[model samples]
Target: MRVLSRVGCHLCEEALPVVDRVCAERGESYDVADIDADPVLVARYSDLVPVVFVDGVEFATWRVDPAALDAALRRPR
Candidate 1:
C-alpha cells in the first residue's frame, strides 16, 4: 500500500491510522510518500494529495475509512 499526502493536511492525518491498521491486519508493506517532496507528484496530486493506493491501484482519496479500505482489499484486482 502507498499513501500520497502533503504536509499540514487534516485529511491526510486522518487517513494514516486507517492505513496503519489495514497494513497491520494484512501484514502488508505500506509506505507514505509526501507528495510535496516531488514536484511532479505535487502537480498531479496537489488536489488529490490524500490518495491511497493498494498494489498500485487507487483505493481511496480525500478521506479514508476502515470499511472502505477493507472492501477494496477484499476486491479482486
Candidate 2:
C-alpha cells in the first residue's frame, strides 16, 4: 500500500496511522509519497492528499476507512 500525502495535512496525518495499524497487523509494508515532492503528483493529488493505494491502484481518499482498508488488504494480490 502507498499513502499519497503532503506535509502538515491533518487528514493525511489521521489516515496514515489507520493504514499503518492495518498494515502492521497484516504484516504488510507500506510507503508514503509526498505529493509535493513531484510535480505530476502534486497536480494530480494536490487536493486529494491522504489518498491510499493498494498494489498501485487507488483505494481510498481523504479519510481512511478501517473496514474498507482491511477488506482491501485481505483481497488476493
Best candidate according to TM-score: 2
lDDT of 2 by residue, 1-77 (tens): 89999999999989999999999988989999999989999989999888999999999999998888999899998
On lDDT, the leading prediction is 2
Question: Tens-digit lDDT track for model 1 on 22-68?
Answer: 77886667889999899999888899869999879888888888988
List RMSD in Å for every model shown: 1.4, 0.6
lDDT value for model 1: 0.86
- Candidate 2 at residue 59, lDDT? 93
- Candidate 1 stretches with Cα past 4 Å from truth are none
RMSD of model 1, in Å? 1.4
Q: Each model's TM-score, in the order given?
A: 0.87, 0.96
Candidate 2 residue pairs that clash: none
